[model samples]
Target chain A: SAVISQKPSRDICQRGTSLTIQCQVDSQVTMMFWYRQQPGQSLTLIATANQGSEATYESGFVIDKFPISRPNLTFSTLTVSNMSPEDSSIYLCSVVFGTGGYEQYFGPGTRLTVT
Target chain B: AQSVAQPEDQVNVAEGNPLTVKCTYSVSGNPYLFWYVQYPNRGLQFLLKYITGDNLVKGSYGFEAEFNKSQTSFHLKKPSALVSDSALYFCAHSNDYKLSFGAGTTVTVRA
Candidate 1:
């Protein structure tokens, strides 16, 4: 299993402000992903953070709203831009590791509350 | 297109009783099903997965899941429930390295 950690475990920010969440893995991983979980809802994939390149975002999410940066295999960041009340959610960092990379491990999410 | 469904929103069980969380999947090819648990204010923890071979796969925390291809179901099970087993459970499927998660089921095991 891969050990993952995230910065700013919980944060409260004013609306229209931006916050960047950092994700670090103990070891190199093949794939890194960011997810969002609304209050009392299931997880939704936000984007795939690719090392040394731009992140691949899922539909309903765009780079302008959530910019991602993956400088290397062990580190990545997701920035929530122009946040609003609806942006208040738990953002999670997940990675795929191990032999076939079938299992994905998640970091203790960053809980953001946009006021 | 590949996805998993957790029909029940919540499940209640007593300590030492059998606990089951139902999950059914729909995919174009062979399914790669997985179960994960999330405690209060914590990240998700992988419990078990069914890739191939064994229909019954055992995982951490004494949890197991049976994959029934005929029913397109991979339901998580535990012979005896523990109070600590109370958490939110998710069923997911992987397609092209991307995961599609179910709506999640909240399990409450009361002592």
Candidate 2:
């Protein structure tokens, strides 16, 4: 199992402000992903962070709204740009490791509250 | 399109009683099924997975899941429930590198 951690565990931000969340993994991994979970909602895949390439975002999410940076195998960042009240959600970073690396693991998550 | 369905929104079980969380899937090919648990204010934790071979897979926290290909279902189970086992549970299916998750089921284990 991979140990993952995120910064800014919980934060309150004003609307229209941007916040960046950092994800660090204890071991190097090839597959990293970002996810969003709205209040009482299921997890939604935001993007797939490639080590040295642009992050591949899912539909309904774009780079302009959520820019991602994967500088290396062990680290990545997701920036929520121009936040709104609706942007208030728990953002999670996950990675795939071990054997075939099919079993995905998640970090504690960043709880953002946009006022 | 690959998808997973968690039929129950919530499952309540008494402590020491057996518990089950139902999940079904629709995928083009053989599916990689997984179960994850989320405690209050925490991220999802890996419980168990069924990639191949075993029909019943055991995982962390004494949890296990039976993969029934005939029914296209992978249901999470526990022989005995604990109050600490109460949490939100998710069922997921993976195809290629993309993994899709179900809406999730909230499990409440009462003592």
Candidate 3:
């Protein structure tokens, strides 16, 4: 199992501003992923961060709105750019490990409230 | 694309009683299924997974899950429920690198 941590566990920001959430893993991992969960809703995959390249985002999500940076294998940051009230949600980071393994260890998540 | 379904919005079980959280999935080709638990203000904790193994898999906190390929189901079970067991549970399915999650089910264990 992997121990992941996020910064700014909860924050309140004004609309039109940007908030960058950080994710750090206790150990190196094969892959890292970002997710968003709306209040009372299911979790949605935002993007997959690569070690030395651009992140791969899911459908209906673009890098312009959720820019991701992964400078190394153990750390990554996801920035919610040009935030709106609709962007208020809990963002979680997950790391993939174990060859041919399906389990993903997730971080506690950063709760963002866009006002 | 793969999808998961958690049939119940909430499940209620008496403490010391057996509990089961139902989960079903739909995917093309092979399926990688997993269960997760989330406490208040906490992250989703890995419970158990059924990739390619025996029908039943055991996990932390005295929890177990059974993988039934014919039903496309992987249900979480516990012989005894604790008050601490009251939390939200999510079912997820993986096809490739991405893992899809269900809406999640809130479980309340009564003491």
Candidate 4:
């Protein structure tokens, strides 16, 4: 199990503004991921933050829209650029830990409301 | 592509009764299934996972899931329901170090 925390637990941002969410892990982890959960919807993987490298994004997401930075093993950030009403969702930070890396633990999540 | 499906959108149960949430998965070779719970205004909490060797796996908050290979199902169950257990539940599977989650199921336990 891992203890993960995200900054700006909840925020309201005006349209066209950008917001960066910070994720901090108690222990160093090899894999860090960012996810988005729309209202009443399932989780969608945004990108995988790699330490000292560019994040690997999934289909339907791009670096220009959702940029990620992982400077070290224990910390990462995801920035939602040029936000809109559709971008209002709960952003989550997750890490794969334990011996076999079979389980993933999630942070409390940042609830972003674009107005 | 690997994916999981949750058949029910919402499940309502009475307190002290049995509870069940259904999940089925589709993957290439072997499946690594997992279950997670989310309360209102909170982050997701890992409930249990089935990597290998176990047909039935137990997890936090008295929750358990049975993995049936032939049926392609990993269903979560609990003997007794509690009002506190009312929340959203998700079923997911891991492939290539990435997870694909199923549509969540909302559970409502009435007192």
Best by lDDT: 4
Per-residue lDDT of model 2, residues B16-105, tens digit only: 999999999998777888999999987899899888898999999999999998999999999999999999999998766567899999
**lDDT against the true structure, each candidate:** 0.94, 0.92, 0.92, 0.94
For model 2, residues A14-69, the per-residue Cα lDDT tens digits are: 99999999999999886999999999999999999988889998999999999999
What is the C-alpha RMSD, rounded to one decimal, of candidate 4?
A: 1.0
Q: lDDT per residue, candidate 3, A2-101, as tens digits?
A: 5789998999999999999999998999989999999998899999998899999999999999999999989999999999999999999999875677
Arranged by DockQ with the best first, the candidates are 4, 3, 1, 2
Which residue pairs clash in candidate 2?
Answer: none
Task: Show where candidate 2 strays beyond 4 Å.
Answer: none
- Please give the fraction of native interface contacts (Cα pairs under 8 Å between A and B) kept by each candidate: 0.71, 0.71, 0.85, 0.82
Kindly state the number of residue pairs that clash in model 4.
0
lDDT tens digits, residues A1-115, model 1? 5589999999999999999999999999989999999999999999999999999999999999999999998999999999999999999999987549587899999999999
Give lDDT for model 1: 0.94
Say which prediction, candidate 1 or candidate 2, comes out ahead on lDDT: 1
> Model 4 TM-score?
0.98
Find the 10 residues in a row with the least total lDDT in model 1 chain A: A96-105
Single-chain TM-score of chain A, each candidate: 0.96, 0.96, 0.97, 0.96
**lDDT per residue as tens, model 4, A1-115:** 5689999999999999999999999998878999999998999999999999999999999999999999999999999999999999999999987559578899999999999
Per-residue error (Å), model 1, residue B111:
1.0
For candidate 1, what is the DockQ-based docking class?
A: high
Better of 2 and 3 by DockQ: 3
